[model samples]
Target: MLASVHSEILREKLLLPGETLVVGVSGGNDSSALLHILVALNKNYHYGWKLHAVHLNHCFRGEEARQDAAYAQELCGKLGVTFHLFEFDVPAYMEQTGMGGQEASREIRYGFYRQVAKEQGATKLVLAHHADDQVETILFRFVRGTRMQGLSGMPKRRWLEEGSIELVRPLLHVTRKELESYCEENGLHPREDSSNRSRKYKRNLLRLEVMPLLAEVNERYREHILEAAEAIHQDHAFLERLAIEQLEKVLIVRKPDEIVIDNEPFQNCDVALQRRMITLILDYVSKQTEWSSQHVEAVLHMSGGSRPSAELHLPGQLVVSRVYGRIHFCPKGREERIHMYCYELPVPGKVWIAESEVWVHTNYLERLTDWERLPENEAVFDADRLPGPLFLRNRRPGDRLALFGSGSEKKLKELLIDTKIPRAWRDRLPLLIAGDEVVLVPGVRRSAAAPVDERTKRFLHVRVEFGEDWREVFS
Candidate 1:
């Protein structure tokens, strides 16, 4: 195991002789093996490397966590290496940040590691993520709806926090089983946390339940996944270079919290580059570690939209908007407060759309009214066909509507643009929804789900009356 890790480090050019390094030790098999391996290599080869073992006790497991920290310190003492232990309240962090347990733990844990590295003036922070861990990560991201970049899994080494510190993983070629066996052979007596077996966490579930099932189907699952990941990494690396070049070319403004790009030049680039460039912007300004592909597509739609200006409100207070000929990304309180609203419409009653200043009136009738004369402002539907009570809300991303004649669903944003709706008013446009379906867009169009036909016994007469001219608001 030591020989393989050394070979991996040398081939990847992971370390230089006598460089200061920080190794994270969790008192588990994986991290313990990593720390011991580095120590062995340092002494045997006369590398003269300065190694610091850092352990963080996330205040969750009570006595078990404290014991883990103590064990890490004892091991470091036995190896005659410097050790540092820190305790942090992960639950409080999650509560304050509204992040999940796993996400908060990782965020604070890496942050603590980086701080220690900076204090020690070390450039490399080593970890023990192995081949099996890599496979799990790839599978997790695949299930969570990611792009090609995520499918590549973790890199052997990457820069953390804008290239200030290097994060190195020398065990990518090793397996967890091998690490455990090495610990047994060396009498390391690594400590184990009870939380790893908890089924409440999705990752633990995957490892404890899903992984063995996959192994049952194919014993070489880990090798196959890692091989595919390596291939994807190569392809993504090529596209990443292109994306960086494209971003530099189209960049009009760049800042820590804001980015602006020339819209025309961005559009001229290949569709693939465009997507990657936007991802680069997101990495810079967005606070979240991961973003869904739908978020990227929404931004793309906004760029090609007919509206002269528009804004897409993303989670974590990040705002992506188009202004004239430039696209801008702003994080941290760009807008004071978003005015998007939703309201329930009562059947056989009336409700008012506050933003659009229109009244929605619904009535049940034995015979259908002459709604064809004003299809834009009124719709007659088969009462029995509505999925549920009508709901009035503003637009959401991926909202689709089925037109009267069109067999397929049309993206609501594109439909609004086709009708020449102002971007400013689009978000405030009243949409009557029935269950998951958008049944009516007053002064725009109606859904095809609840059609009025001669066979219809009961009727749904829905009408909207604008305080001002409805045409003025929509335009």
Candidate 2:
């Protein structure tokens, strides 16, 4: 059995040369067996992959948890492989973070694995989640009324954090019973975590109680469950591709944070495609695990908002805003009062806005037609007439600026209040100032003293671009 399973894995994918593989060995039967097989493969075949074992002592089981780490260390020593152990205060962390036991444990364990994998110079972090685990995940998501992505169960590989390390589940096709049988046949010793039998966790109850009853009715229940998960995974991939194509047509993915959805095009899509369209938008905004069906339904119904202006908040801090017959999916924490700064022009060049990446630049001269063509919001000043070392700073309370052409000064606060600039943006907007006087407010207004005149030696060319992805930035 052990040889057959080993042969099956070898038939799948050969490890690339000089590949560094990190295996999570929790001393449990599944993980320990996985480590033993990988170690064997490392030696039996001249596979140039170096093996490193990682164990996270959750500290929930006290000394027994330490014993589990010790067992993993002993196993690694016997196999002559490098071992890493991480101890975490799971209970205290759970209380502090208000996360359930399983959630906390998962977060800590995976976090430790990713960190250790990076430190050990590993490219891939492998886990021993088998077919039975996938089936249980499917059942759990099904009970929660999840979409197809949830029913698809676990994936083979995914990048958790870009450029760090990839998550790989190597034995996903193998069954738990098959792993244990391989360990028994190969004389491989494995530790059994006592928590596995405890019904305190929801997963444990489903595994120990529900799965056994189903298996009693059918001998090949595990195979059937795995087949269902595989089918769902295939279907989910197809839907995801279709959604991505549809999003390219109906969505303006402005940036990683900003996206604009065309409600007119979305409403024209079929009802089945409507759900997928909403899901693609939510995923692009949040990258969350699962969104409820009810929320997707609500977004679909919101295609035609009876209210002229309406906004809705969904899971993962996603905000859907509707305006002028267009629906937009905006990120949360973006709805604060605008902050404006009074900045002094600095050397007639680009200036950076600290609150936002937006940059402002000034050029020497432009055609009269160019000045007129510039948007009223953009500040085009007479560069030569302006003093050097112009400063850019945020707007302050009681700040006053001379109105252009009117030659009358008004308090910045009073103007902002009349314009209905939200109170939060008072301190965030970039204010251009030359010494004691305000020069220009990019995307807002220009100071009177800095207005274009014949005496102006240089015609300023001003434009704004974000710190990142200049091409995708809005004017």
Candidate 3:
């Protein structure tokens, strides 16, 4: 078993020389076997790996949990390896996040693992997830409705924190039965969790009831499921690469708060690529793996058709909007129509707009230097020719502006439409209002009322700084 496991690890290239490795141990058969195998491989084969064992107590099983942590510590001590133990309040976490017992436990457990790996300076974090886990995951995702990405199951090796920490599952090719047999052969007494026998959890019910029933129908159901997952993983990887290429072409703007895509280019892609691109965009913005096939379908539905405008509220507080020839995907409150308010702009002062989360800084300059070379987000206006105290706010009804270089005055709404601004974003766009007149619309058109050519003695330099992407509000 050790020789085969070592060969599998080598084939997978899970470890490199002179690197620190953190192994997650739960005092269960699978993890015990993993720890023992890794230690043996390092000692006999000189794998040159600095190994550290980490155990997280979920604080659910009371005495049994403490016993498991103790056993893990003693086992590591006997093997002359370092041990780290941490405890978490899984129930409290579940209550706080409104998650179930299983999800909260898993989230806290992995968070603890990552924290330990970082503290230990480990480059790779190892888990004992075997082929059985992969099969279970695939079945679980399928039963709950998933896309190809979720059906692909767990990966063998992946970056947990891009470029910082990696996660490796060396036992992915090994079965639970094999690991149990190896533990017995090595005389490793592993603790069994009683919760695994409880049928309250869906996974337990699937493993105890559904899996056996399926096995009765087909003796090799588990093996077949694992094979299917592997195939889907390969196909998903290929499609994901193609989707990324297509995304770069159609993606108009990508920011932490939102992502904009050209409707024509996105609509022209194959259905598979379109679905993948939508999923990629959601995943990138949310930074969470909770998006489902339903969310993807909702986005696709909203972006489809020749409808002038449509909007759909999705999971994770995300809102997908399709306006004219553009698709906007952003957080719920970030979606264009933010609350409108007017605040006095103080000269030589900075004001942070809570509604838009933007900072408007105004400075008085004696004279303008290279006025035509100002940045896109900055504008200089004649201070002496101003109508009254300047006020900054969103576009209001009946707002009109005499666009620069255009003699005729146009309504703010008409100007925005002519400028090709998404209809949904017109209300959220910031404007510098002087008394009843519009002076400057940052990153867009500037009012012809405050043109500064040469007679200006004092100039007001106003700059808009957005905490997130300025393009979301301006472009």
Candidate 4:
């Protein structure tokens, strides 16, 4: 059994030499047995690595929790691996945070493990989710109306945060029966977690009850479950790629808060692709709660104009609002506001704004006589002629601007009104300021103070374009 798991690990390239391995030791049979097998493998195979055991204590079962922590500590001591433990009152956390019992416990436990892994400089954190656990997860998500990704179950390895290491499930292909058999064969004493016996959990019921019925029908029931999961996992990967492509093509995104979508794409796409697109939108829009099929269907129904300017308040502060025949997804309380920043125009560099990119080049400076030729959101300035240092910034109340050829002080809002720009659009418009004076409002007006002339030594030529969406292209 160890040899087969070792072969799978090697085949998957799950572990690399010379990196710290942080094993999540729950003091349960699965985790404890996994630790023993990995330690034995490390010693026998001369795998160059450092090992540390992490135990997250939810403090739910009192002495039972302490016993689990103690057992993990003992195992770490016997194996000469460093051990770390953290405890939290999960019940209080659930009440305060409004997260459910299992959900809160999982979030807390994984959060602790990630912090520990970072502190220990671990390259990969190991989990003991065996084949049966994956099957249960797939079934659970299916019952919960999950799309393709959830039905695929847990990934074998995924980066929790890129370059911060990953959570790896090396025992994914290993079964509980196989692990128990291996433990008995090697005379390894493993502690059973008492919580597993509680049939209150859906997974517990499946393991103790539903699985027996399936096994009686076919002795190779576990193998069938594993095979089905593998096939679903492949399908999930394909659909994920498709979803990403659709997101890139049709997603109307605004950074950190808003995403606007046109109804045309969904109305045009096949239902399968439409479901995939919905999953991508929910996942990318915000780190919201697990989206249900009903939520997607509701959004789709809204896209079909089920209501008059309807709004759906989703989990994680996401607000889906329908306005002007487009569905907009934004962080709650953010729709009525615009966050604008005055940024420096670095010569020969790029300026990023919501759904737009501005490239400033010296050669492009000659093309503009008046800023009116610029997009309603762009402007150009003579770099060398600006009063000492130029600054990019926001509009403040009582702010005055000198309209070119008209020396009278004009309010920024009044100028925006004259230009026929909406109040919201005006809020995000970049205002070029030079020494407390509005030098230029790109794509709008330029100050009489700094007019482009042949005497201008260095020119700031800016090219700005807007689109429905933007991405972190450099990164």
- The clash tally of candidate 2 reads 27
Ordering by lDDT: 3, 1, 2, 4
TM-score of each: 0.69, 0.76, 0.81, 0.70
RMSD of each: 15.9, 5.2, 4.5, 7.3
Off by over 4 Å in 1: 286-288, 315-317, 334-475
1-475: candidate 1 lDDT, tens digit per residue: 7788889989999988988899999999999999999999999998888998889888999999999998999999999889989999999988998878877788788888888899998889999999899999999888877777888988888777566778899998899899999999999999988999899989899999999999999999999999999999999999999999988998877777888788899999998888888877887886446666777788888988887888898765688888666787887564343377888888799997777677999888877556566658788888888888778888888999998767778999999877766464577678888988898887888888778788888887888886743443443
lDDT of 2 by residue, 394-439 (tens): 7765678888878798888877655544343456666676766766
Select the stronger candidate by TM-score from 2 and 3: 3
Q: Candidate 1 deviates by what RMSD?
A: 15.9
lDDT of 3 by residue, 367-390 (tens): 777876787678888888888779
**Candidate 2 global TM-score:** 0.76
Deviation from native of the Cα of residue 11 in model 4, angstroms: 0.7
Worst 10 residues of 3 by lDDT: 466-475
Q: What is the lDDT of residue 277 in candidate 4?
A: 76
* Tens digit of per-residue lDDT, candidate 4, span 94-195: 889787778788778778777878888888988899988887887767776777678678889987655678879989888778888877887767777787
Q: Each prediction's Cα lDDT score?
A: 0.84, 0.73, 0.85, 0.72
Off by over 4 Å in 2: 7-11, 160-164, 250-342, 346-350, 362-370, 380-427, 431-441, 444-475
